[model samples]
Each structure stands twice: as C-alpha cells, then as structure tokens.
Target chain A: MTEFIPPGTRFHPLPSPFPMKRGGALVGAHVAFETWGELNAARDNAVLIVTGLSPDAHAAANEGNPEAGWWEPMLGPGKPIDTDRWFVVCVNSLGSCKGSTGPASMNPSTGALYRLDFPDLSVEDGADAAASVVRGLGITRLACLIGNSMGGMTALSLLQRHPGIAHAHINISGAPRALPFSIAIRSLQREAIRLDPNWNHGQYDEVTYPESGMRMARKLGVITYRSALEWDGRFGRVRLESDRPDEEPFGLEFQVESYLEGHARRFVRRFDPNCYLYLSRSMDWFDLGPDGLRQIHVDKVLAIGVHTDILFPLQQQQEIADGLREGGADATFLPLESPQGHDAFLVDIARFGPAVAGFLATL
Target chain B: MTEFIPPGTRFHPLPSPFPMKRGGALVGAHVAFETWGELNAARDNAVLIVTGLSPDAHAAANEGNPEAGWWEPMLGPGKPIDTDRWFVVCVNSLGSCKGSTGPASMNPSTGALYRLDFPDLSVEDGADAAASVVRGLGITRLACLIGNSMGGMTALSLLQRHPGIAHAHINISGAPRALPFSIAIRSLQREAIRLDPNWNHGQYDEVTYPESGMRMARKLGVITYRSALEWDGRFGRVRLESDRPDEEPFGLEFQVESYLEGHARRFVRRFDPNCYLYLSRSMDWFDLGPDGLRQIHVDKVLAIGVHTDILFPLQQQQEIADGLREGGADATFLPLESPQGHDAFLVDIARFGPAVAGFLATL
Candidate 1:
C-alpha cells in the first residue's frame, strides 16, 4: 500500500548513516514535519508537538496547506496551543508511513520497499529523529515540548537522552513504559493482521491488501479508544433499521457494530500495515525504567490524563507527575473526568484544551 | 471439528418437530444434562443449572461421570450448590456443542451437519430447552434456578416464558440485555470467524479448520473475560524467558501475549467454529428490556457481579436486582471486589461461592 502523506508536509534530511537504537542504520532518510506560526528572533519561542500513532504532521493548516488538520481545533491561531503566541512544530514519528521514512518507503540500499527488512524501530529512535528535526529548524532550546499518547514516550526519551532540549514539557495520555494490558491488546491486534493470509508476510499489494485483518485491528482499537460508558450512552442496544444481509447471517445488526464497521473500512486502506506493525511493536518494547524520569532537567512539567482512559489510566499521568517532581521539576498532575477514554485528548477539547493552555500560559 | 461432549452425559428427547423461537423447527432433537444427588419423591428439592457458552452439562462429577466439570469447585455433595441437600441438574445450553444439539449436530431430515443451516438460536430457545428437561424429569418447580453469564439471559427468559417454572433465581454476572460495547465485541468475534477462508460458509471440517480465525476470536474473548487490573497484577511487563521465534517477527515477546496464545490454542478446535458463531450471535441478540424483567414472577432473586467485570459489568447485575425487586420479588444485589473481572464467578470462587451458598440456604 502507498504511504499516506498530507499535502505541504515538509521533510528534514537526517544525517547520513543515522544509527537506530536496536542496532541498524538508515541512509538517505528524512523526517516529515509541518510548522504553524513563525519562530521568534531568539528561536526559543518554538514549541514542538510530537504526535501519537497514526496522526500525520499536519496537525493544523498553515500557509502551505489551508485544509483543516487532525488537531485543528486546538492548534490554530488563538486556539489552545495558540499559534499567535507559540510557533508549533508537529513531526510525524520516524516509523510512521505518513510522509516519513518507514517500512513503506523505498530503501536507498536495495531500491525496494523495506517491509520486514526494515530495522527494528524503537520509541527512542523516534525521539532522536524528532530531536534532529528540532535542531535542523535552528532551535537551540524549545520553550516547551508537547507530546500526546505514544509521543509522550518519545518526549520522555528526548528529555532523558538530550538534556536541556526543552524548558517545560506537557505529557498527555502517555506512559513511561508499556503496561501489560496495553501490550496484550496490541499483541492481539498485530496477530489479527499477521493471521490474514492476504498479509503474506508483509508482501501484500493493493490487490491483495489485508483488509479484513486491518479491519479487525482497527475495530479493536476503536473499542479501546473510548470508554464503555460512552458506548452505552451513545448506542445502547440500538439495532440497525435495515434488514441484515441474508447471505451473511451474522452481518451488521446493532448500531455499535455498524459504527465499528464504518470506522474500520475507512481506516484499512489509509495506513500501511507494515508501518503499523513496526510502530506497535516498538511500543511493546518501550520501558523507561523508574530512574529514567528523574534524569530529566525540565523547568516545569504537566501530565494530563482522563479517568475513563483504560488504555492509559489516570494513575499513569500521576506517575509522570510524581517522577518528574522527584527530579526537582515543578510538576503538576491534572486528571479530567472525560468519558472518551484514551482518545479524550483529541476529542474532549473542552476538558483538555484549557489544561494545556493554562500550562503554556505559566511557561 | 467434532463436538466436545464429556463422558456419561444423558439426553432427553424433545417433543417431535421441536419448534425454535425464531421461525424454524428441529426434528429428533435432544437436550443433554447430568445430575448430581437424588430428586426426592416430592421433587421439590430439585435445583437446575443453565450454563454460559462453551460449558458441558457435567457441571460436577456424578456417579455416572467422574470427570470434574467446569463448575466443579462450586458444585458437588458438600460444595457451594450442595448437591447432598438439593438434587442439582445442569443442562448444556441448547446451541452449544458440548453434548447438546447445536450446529455441530446432524439434521434428522438431511442426515448431514446442520452448520449454517441451523435455525437462528436465541437465549429464549435455550431457556425453553432447559425448561423441557426440568418438566421431563417430573419436577413441577425448581428449588432455585442458577444462571451464569449467557445462562443468566436464558434463566431470565425461562422465568418470563415459563411462569412458575422456577421459584427462585440466582443470576451471576448476567445482564438484562446486551450492552452496545458487548455487542460490538461479539460482532467482531463473529466477523473474525466468517472472514477466515477455511470457514467456507461454516462448512469447515477437521482438515479444513479455521484455526487462525478461531484463535483470534478466542484471544479477544480471553482479553475481555479478565480485568486490566488482574493482567497488571499477574504479568506486568514480564517478558518471555525464551527468545521470540525468528520466523515470526511479531511473535510472542511478553508473558501476557504468551498467556493469550496458549489460551487461544487450547480453545480453537475444542469447540466447533460454527457453533461458536451461533452462540456468540445469540448473546448479541439477547435483550430483556425493562418491561421484560418486570414480567418475571419469582419468589426470591440474587444477582452477583464483580466490580472489575467489563464484559457484563457490575451495574448490569445491579440492574437485574433492581428490576427484579420492582417485580415484587425479594431480591439482593451483591457486588464483590474480585479483580478477576467477568470470569470472577469461575475463578474467584472464594467470593462467589459463599454468595451462592448463602442464597441457596435461604431457599
């Protein structure tokens, strides 16, 4: 499948022979990024926005791309992140297929798709790539670093690996390490993809794309992305008005089932399956031991989470606060009661936006 | 695959041309059951157990069958159900493959496996079949009716459909209707089975089994069956002792993944995939609305659930208690603090056992 790159996404060439964390190197590689607003004369007013899995660098529309981005509600001028005051840079993680060099990219060495031949990707490698992009933009020190979900892991790695990279940090719905429950869920998701005969060891073409496997994986993800409370409130035993297809006896019957089917169908062809596998396994392998947080030297830290998020529970945010506080940073933990679960940071702007804005105002 | 029937399960012939709840009839049909203890001359001391999906009629070892049953710890001579005092009859759910006439059974008219040709099976049908077994044994009324998980739905249907059939009811981790979250989960499970090429419209045999699809479905079930808290407490970030398989890049790396893989492998071939699809869809179709609960006429009722249960959550059990209480029955809702989640009734018997025995003692 083709890589999903948004229009006007800028690329930053990495140093030749860039070393990967798990003993591999990439040559002639580049990271995809998009910027909103301009850096001040000092170049210290820049705020880097690292994203979660599946989001492109197109967080919000800029001069180059007028289309609304994924986090358009919170990233535009005078919005929560406020492009009027802060120059925001959002970079697609290194292993993503969204205009970034990943398994879907042609290997300079072999002139073929990397696929399974791609070296093992880790969250740390993503951190290094983001760091390189920040440096390439002529920013010596970011005013603040914002990371959401998987990017939270990357941010922590950045702070630990490259000290004094940022003055303050905002970790949203992320963990220092992968939890067992989350690992199990992702494991099943990868299993679903691999089990598809169409997957064919990642050699699948557009004609034989692993649509069913990707559908199942995406459905499982959508289920965990929200809380059961939200599901009950929204769809509660609501059956489809139309008759189920006679040929498929167990076809769509409930509204919730139809909702999931719609979601999975839209997603299966949009993202490269190989890139998903690599990024997902990278999370499972992430573990920033207890001491990793204490090594960071940021001035201030804000860890935001929602109570309904089972994927990254509220306690994980509290742990971030506690750990960063132990490192002598003025850390504050804010837990919101959003019913959207792990995806609340993206959808529940009413709850998350103010917290982020207030934290940035302090900086 | 073949039906997984335990030794010494007795069958009671159904009325010829047994009618199904959803527009079809079964010929030469039978309901499978196993008994422990003896029914008195008055038959008033008889107790009946309807089961969740995938359990056999042999709930406990009997004189005819010495093998330990699924609920062995909670049943027997001096166990929680206390067969020594009450003659206990456990019936295999009608649409299940464990010694019951399910999709795996041969059709009398066609002399071939029913498979997808089997009529739509509902929880009500299972209730009717269990009611038939009770009446066939010459028992006018049950001392107490016990239902666990899906069986709880069947037991509710029994009380509403067959008035005065059971004098008391004990619902363990059961819901009045299917929740949207649960329906979505089960729908995905059915989709997984149907998408497998080997399923071949439910014409799979031992040689052409849809093992991968079944494995994925079972793994999904196992993940939802237990709570995230239990997973964290049991295998938090524990890696496998052995190295991951070199051939499979996304193979088992963590202990939780290994646990799910082991669990799914043991379950795939044990139960027929067609039977699984039928039974799973039946639960998605089960919904006894607010008025349905009010229609039930029983003397005493007890609904038990655990706080950690996400599949059939604690509020659902409370709903059962509240609804039944409104129906003029003496009902008690007991929520236990078991970290085992939905499967707590099966594994955390220390808490579930006393509740069942206490309810039965009053009966």
Candidate 2:
C-alpha cells in the first residue's frame, strides 16, 4: 500500500488507515528516512537516529550529497555514530514537513492539505511509523537507538511499544513528559501563530502565510533553548550599532535581539506552523513512567542530560534513568556541564560525542 | 505652570516645556503622587516611594478610599515602611499611564492624546519628575527612598542626578543595568504589541485595541518574572481537565497556561500597550555603573536580591552593593532565597519584610 525507495534518503509509506493515539486514524501515511553504511546480512547492525523538532531525515553528508546536516558532527566514517561500522537510519518525524507525510501533505479522502485536519499524534504514533519503516528495511532488531529532546521521548516510546526491538538506547536532553514551564512557553508560541491575521484558522495560502507569528514564536524559542549565563557572557548588552538612525528603534536595539530575529527568519522559511503546533502538543502529551519503562526490553540504556537545559532540565533525564533502572534495565546516567542548555546535544560535540560513543562501544 | 492639588492623592505639575532624555519635550507635563501621614514641620522625615513599571501612586489604603493598593502588605501603620513613624510619598513614574503624564495624557501643543507622539523618557527623567513633586510639597531632603525593579533604577538615577536629595536608599530585586537576557525578553514583548494587526502603530481607539498583543506580551512577562523551580514545584504537568472534551483543546489544557492567560487578561485590561512599550524600552536603556554610583551622597544603602531571580539575578544586586561600598558608602547586601524569583519582593513578605525593617531601623 506504500512505496519504498532505496536506502540513503527515501520514503516508506504506511499501510492504509494507520491508526493514531487518542482515537483517530490517518490514510496514505508515509515516513522519510536516510541511511548510512551497509546493512549486514543478518540485518542486525542498524542504529536508528531520531531528531528534534525542526531537523529532518538528513542527519549527515552522504555520497550523493556532500552537504552537512543538523547532526553532522556526530555522524560520519569515524565519528561518534561511526557510520563505517553500522548502518545509521535517521527518520524525519511523523508530523514534520521535511519530506514526511504531515500537516503539509495532501489528504487522500478530501484531496486537500491536512492542515489542522491532521489527527492528534502521540510519541507512540511517531514510534509506530518509524517501526514500520524499520521493518520494511528487513531489520528484525536495532543495534542501537539514539534520540535528542522530543526524539528522546520517541525513543522511549519505541522501546515501550515494541519490546526487545533494540539492543541498546541513548536518550539525550529528553524528558519523560513536558514540564509546565516548557508547556507554557510552547502554548504562547502556538498562540503567536494563531493570532496572526494571515493564519486564517490554519487555512492560509502559501503567499499569505503566518510569517510574523512564526518569526516571533521562533524568537521566543531561541531564548529558552539557551542558558542565561551563555547569553550574558556572549551578548552582554552589546548594541547592534545599526547605521540607520532614522528607523524605528524598538526591536533591533540589542545584539541578542538581532541574533534571535535572524534565527527566527531562517526557521520560518523552513518550518510549517501547523506542524509545529501539532508536534509541540505531541511533546506535551508524551508520558513514560515506570510502567512504560518496564515494557522496554533493551540490554543497555544511557541517559544524557545537560546541566543548563531549562526545557527538559537535568532532573528529567535522571528520572528516565531511574525509571529504567527501577524496571530492571542496565541504565547509566551521564550529566554534562555545558552552557548550550537543551540545545547542547546539537552544539557541544566534544562533550556529548564521547559519552554517546563510549556507550555504543559497550553495546 | 501646572496646578498642584492638596497633599493626599494629588497631582504636582512641572514647569512648561519639560525636557526629555533624547531631545523633544512634553508641554504641560505633570506627576501624580499619593501622600501618607504628614510631612514633619522640619520637612526632613518624608519617605519617597517610587513604583515599578505597572504600579501606581496608590501604595496603600488611604482616608479617601479604603481600597488596598498593590503594595498594601508592605505599607501600613507598623509595616516595614512604618507609616506611623514617617511620612510616605509614592509617585507614579513619568511615562506611565496611571493618572500620570504619559502616552495616554493629552499633549497641550496638539490637543490630543500623545500616543506615539510622546517623547522618549529615562530613569533620570522619572526621578526629576518625582523630585519636582517633592519640591512642590516644600520638602528639600527625603529621609529615605525605596524602589524595586525599574523603580530601583530610577532611585539610583535620582541619587546620581541630584546628590544628597535622599539620606538613604534601598534597592530591591533591581539591577544597575538591564542584561541581554532581560532585554531580549522585553524586546519580544514590544514586538508582540507592534505586530498586532489592530495596533495600527499605537493609534488604535479603545474599542479596537491591540488587546491580543498586550495579552500575549503579559504572558511572556509572567514567565520571565518567576523562576522555573517555582513553576516546576507548583504546576508540574497538572491538567485543567475540563468536563467538555469538545471545547477546542489548544490553550486550556495545562493549568499553567490558564494561570498565565488569566494574568495576561487582567494586565491588558489595566495597562496601556503604548506605555508598556515605552517603559519597557526605558528599562532596557537603564545603565548605572561606578560613575553613576560615585555620585550618590547617601549615608547608608541596602541592596536586596532573590536567589531565584533570572531577570535581575542576585549577582547584579551584589554588584550594586559592592559598587556603593567601593565608592565609600555604607552599603549592606542581603541576598534572599525564595522560589518567587524576581517577583519575590512582591510575593514573599515574610523574608523581604524583616530585611527591609531591620535595615530601616538602622537608618
């Protein structure tokens, strides 16, 4: 019912009428993935990599494309992931718009964009979609499963829903469930999008998009993703020093504001607002307690947390490790001191890479 | 010249052509203040209380009205302020819209609301207006000056601009200069107002106001004002759990969101968006360093900071105390440990009250 292209960035369609969590189903569903290295004859040497909110299936440079990906530093021939030793599978998340069937995709039943009509998704649903892709690749078991942030929640859900599917798991800067402070931050982001006059209740055309709302929301996101210490050390009330004195002196006063606005503009160009709303809500809905961890039958698990991460925080990672350990799993906790906050997993290659590599070596 | 009403809850007008910080002046400018107790015959026992960004001159219940004020807990007969022992003067800042000369006030030259046409203001300008009010009451020197947040900056500016005006000073949860983190937070809030389609560049009438933008901005403010630890302990993943499941499950899911939205709605009702933008920018521009503190002619200074304050961290308050001490003034630093964060001075009376009372007893 779904076509499967070759490895190295391909799409795999789900069976028709794919059921979702919270009582809803999606039709003509598919997932996009990219692979590195070769799959062993036994199909047991595959390492699965899940991404954060905005990243895509392109995790690193491949033979066809020399361009670097979001996690380029952690992947390569001799990098932490060690693509030479294992086949690395990176899946674009279920609700994302980057080469994936999401809110931007056409609805088979209505012949229109899914938009707000997309069914509510859970981390478990995203895991099921990724599982379908894995099974289609003729893999019975994963050598290792790794994820960061929201991806971390999906990794836990994957292990819970499909027990014994992975030999080892690594969760980086991920939470068992979204905290109240983070939920409040994301709720405001969604409100920013919905308040845009161009949003038109999620029915805007491409030319008249909710760009301002998305831009403002991303500005807020960048602020929360980094630590105050880091911002203080870096910006420190430095003026932007613009040449135009006649322009309105409201938004572009501080260097940090300019940096945030630049990042917001770049993000709004790539991300779909509806997809952001759905995925952010999905993160809020994610919950994996002792019972859920008890269902995960992995051999070894390593939980990595950054000290400065306010969104997920170090305590959430500790909870994950504790939950897995309490459920009779070999779980190790690695806490890192980095100023990058929740984005440390994506930025600090020196600290995060070694911990992930050391964990993979044992498995 | 502007008219001056009686001592209790009245307006003191400044001379014609009141100059501002960055050029441009306000004609027929006046300052609104409320007096508690009586100025001594010597005119030397008056306590001047400058307000934060949102508060008004109504610091406590008075004879005219029995309604409680914003800082009612801290300002009674035997409270930390000690109205029974000393006369108190609370003045609304220069650019605020609470019965003060601000964007909402009429411009004599144009015979219309100043709105966006209002001149830019600074902490020093606010201090000058309050100084004029004190002189209007025929008091040359104040016993003490107390301010918190933006008001603290104004008090410091007053000491720098006109030395020996106040005998002693107390700065609570305020920084000598606004940091990049706080500037970025406030910048986004202003952007929210400017981006509102109904804003119309701060010229909207009462009916078609930029209420959504102000509501969203206030939500952001509440997030930054409080600590993450407090929210985590108080509202960690608690759902609102409505009985009706069909009422658009977007914003009303989490209790935290509901809390923030409720505060935002109440703030939007009471605050003018244009004044918010102006005052927020002024806070960003406030920077008083060694050069400024060296001009202080006070005998004693007390600087209090909350450990959980992310906006104005304890380190900033420590800097103020250290700067004043280094400049040969008797400055005492009190670091508070409260989960209330920057808003601790407003919420936690048990801790902050004793510190202020003890310090005032010394003065």
lDDT per residue (tens digit) for residues A227-300 in model 1:
89999999998878875733477888888988998899999999999999999999989988969888779999
lDDT of 2 by residue, B202-315 (tens): 888779899999998999999988988899899987777773332753556888888998899888868888889999999988888647676567888999999888788898
Each candidate's TM vs. the true structure? 0.98, 0.94
Cα displacement (Å) at residue A194, model 2: 0.5
For candidate 2, write residues A1-363 as lDDT tens digits: 022112356889888799998778988888999888999888888999988888888888897556788899999899998988899999999988887788888888899889988988788889999889889988989999998899999999998888878988899998888888889899999899989888877888779999999998899999989988889899987887763322764658778888898899888858888888888889988888637765667888899998888788899899888888877779999999998898998889999989988988887
> Candidate 2: misplaced stretches above 4 Å?
A1-8, A243-246, A289-295, B1-8, B243-246, B294-297
In model 1, residue pairs whose N, Cα or C atoms come closer than 3 Å (at least 3 residues apart or on different chains), thus clashing, are: none
Query: Best candidate, lDDT-wise?
Result: 1
Candidate 2 steric clashes: 0
Question: Which ten contiguous residues of candidate 1 chain A have the minimum total lDDT?
Answer: A240-249
Give the chain B TM-score for each candidate: 0.98, 0.95
